[model samples]
Target: MRGLLLKLLFSLMLCLFILGTVLTAFVWYVFNYSDDRPRSSSHPIRKNPEADPSGVCKECRENTIDKMVEIHSHTWKKQEANFKKFRSQLTSRCHGATKAIVTQVNTPLESKIVYDGEKRKPLVVTPKLFSTFLKEQPFKNVTWETCAVVGNGGILLNSSCGEEIDSAHFVFRCNLPPLDKGYEKDVGNNTDLVTANPSILLEKFEGLMEHRRPFVESLSSYRDSMLLLPAFSYGHNTPVSLRALYTLQDFNSPVQPIFLNPEYLQSLARFWRAQGLRAMRLSTGLIVASLALELCTNVHIYGFWPFAQHPHDRRPLTNHYYDNRQSKKTVHAMPAEFAHLLRLHGQGVLRVHLGQCASGPR
Candidate 1:
């Protein structure tokens, strides 16, 4: 009986192997002979040119290299010499490092906003209400040796700047960026202060009308950082910004929401306008950079390139480090902002990280 069972098992294994080999041979024959067609030498395959989502054609993209104007590796040493020198040019008197611009008394209510030209006379923040957000009040000691302002520009892709960025005494990232999903190496994991646009609240959280856990969970990555918002900048921004503040407060989140003093933003705009930058409004990155100039002794900016092309290889890049969403050119004069930042970089006021960050010479 044992010998008979062994013979039957051996026969089954051989049958299975023959069947697999036959199926493999049949599939190979079908794939190879299925699409036989006579090739015409004169009618060879023609490939379409690559399309640019920015709507620029190949010719236009080719000429963009010639139109590149900002100071770069090719031009920084040569062009910085031509620009006039200044001693730490600053605009606002209300940076955290020097003085607390918005304590209980100095909140600017009557100052006109940058975009709407309306006075913020109605906005108010009570001292009792503000003190409840953070019990520790860590910002009481405003002096920081070094700070990293991480902009969401696509130039940061492949920068490998996570370790360098996290090494700073404080790190500020604009618009809540996903630090997970393989992005931590390029964007870093630390967050001391993060500024949020009212539009982000509306678009991402549906104005926080329902299911608040996602919003609260997102704030967890920042740990005990401050959530800075331009609550009084625009008239429409007030409602949504307030909702965000409430969301954090209601959840007892570690992330504390801080409304930026409108007067500081106004002063910052006026200061940059005087510096020869032309735009409807300065970008958040520029605003953050301007504030960084005052808040820390050494400010290192990452991911701030404005052009679609990479600085080194000149390949096309997305509008943001996270996504390729099309940006409005008319809303903010991005090139002009980049030009000013480039000039500041030339002046040695702050360091801008253009390419990948390395252990040596960074």
Candidate 2:
């Protein structure tokens, strides 16, 4: 009888436990069922886009206005002093650069990739197995007087700055941008040196893995300009860049293919970092402009603006003059860089040409 009583109590306990578990699970399901079930909307909700950090923001606009007012109100003597200071800062390291650039293949051959922030290794050029036609920097003998470093920014569209751009003794273009179509009037036909981003190799030429004829044919507009590639910037870019050289040679293209000295890039990065730009890497246009400051007696930059809207008016413009490729917020602090460039322009250290160049010889 006592055993039967104990078993009855045990059965009652088990029933109670099962009931409690069921109740707890039901409560949990009631709370979380909506999370699992999808909510289908009849009408889609449109969200407003966030502001671009790469472009001029509200604060930048206000600051630019303040600087303009300050410049307009200031005396010529003060501006001259500022310009002198700016010139000193830019040319402090890069004037008549020799060791900074790789003049010989042996300089970097068998050398580890020490340039830039990344620590990469074992990158070498074996002449016995790997042959390169590119021997040295192409324009080592030339000294440019008036140099123009053109940005591919959409601000150059309809600006008619081509004549002004061509007037420069030397011109630097970024990313092997198209010079044909209707862009010649704004971006100019002259090209001294154009830097091709490694990304361009992958995207446009399929990393030059096959059918390099398209790549060679694309250089028709550039015609005898030097093709500068950041081949050693990263170890992966080396093969594609070397292939580009071979392609040019096989077709005997007039465009002289040259690779950028990683050391030159590293020094350029350090220069910008000292100027308060904490970026992963400096933009190609900015690097070209920095080189221009050292190489050219007078520098005139066109299409360097990095704002979505016109600084004077609030009208939006295309991100690039060539294609409507939407730009994302980048590691490069473009607005701050532009502001620094504007300040330099204010002091007459360089000329920043924006929108609609006046016709005739610039």
Candidate 3:
């Protein structure tokens, strides 16, 4: 009787050990390997939508539908009001009438006479009309290609990166100057897309008209290119004016103006007004702009960090990019938010190489 009881106890211990091992293996598989498989109706496991569109299951679909309803009903209205308030602040602070004059004087022309007509002014080409024409123009079938988003960081200077930047099937920049002198030697002359945000343009080129002329000259170098524009808002008036001026000048380049959905802006406005949500909102515009360029396979970012770590101490400072002239000691400090951006870099969604490259000063 004693021997039989001992044998039964040993068997029970073995069974428990086996069960624990199996449970450990199941947990590991669920956390790590489950995301690797193809999702289908027949399969019980669901896949990530960003990795595989077909991985969505019935439950996930229902959850998405519910979330969409919540965003539209509860979130959108709140965002719209916040955006209006921000607009009001910009108008009141900047002096509405003066800003209007600046917009008018700098606005791009509607059309220009490219050819002379016998009686009426010859048919003109304007950025507004040019974009319309491009839409009507059908594109020939072509294989997908990679694109590089080059920032105007001094870091590219003397880096011998012109070849690399130009090697991409398509390249994008912001406000290319006409004369190819300073950092242009390494940055290259082949540009397929030029981003023209109204606020950025106004802030960068408001008084520097001579510097603006080269951008037009540079456009002449590329056979196919686009002047990217954003939809109008009080915060974006300056960039819009610069785009309008470029159009008025008859740069003869294709123009693509992206009108972001009002819903997206409303979300952004709410996010920005929130005490701790502004940094997330700040990068949302870049993400939105990147989405518009569906033609590009990969989009690399440069010179985007409003504040970058100083080389000596590795602390965030405002004195990196020439364009960011605002005092370093602003009312808002974004350390926590910048850390979130670094997390995004680790996720491989964007390549944020602000001061890492040794070509030039940031």
lDDT per residue as tens, model 2, 165-192: 8888899999888888888999999998
CA RMSD per model (angstroms): 18.9, 7.9, 25.0
lDDT per prediction? 0.71, 0.74, 0.44
Residue 189 C-alpha lDDT in model 2: 92
* TM-score-better candidate, 1 vs 3: 1
Per-residue lDDT for 107-216 in model 1, tens only? 33343234333664454445544442333333555657788999888888788988899999888889888787788888888999898888888888898888888998
Candidate 3 per-residue C-alpha lDDT over 157-188 given as tens digits, one digit per residue, 9 for 90 to 100 = 34465655666676667644331545445566
> Model 3 reaches what TM-score against the true structure?
0.43
Model 2 TM-score, all chains together: 0.76
Candidate scoring better on TM-score of 2 and 3: 2
Cα-based lDDT at residue 47, candidate 2:
39
Superposed model 1: Cα runs more than 4 Å off: 1-70, 74-88, 91-102, 108-117, 124-141, 360-362
Worst 10-residue lDDT window, candidate 2: 69-78
What is the TM-score of each predicted model, taking all chains together? 0.72, 0.76, 0.43
Clashing pairs in 2: none
Best candidate (score: TM-score): 2
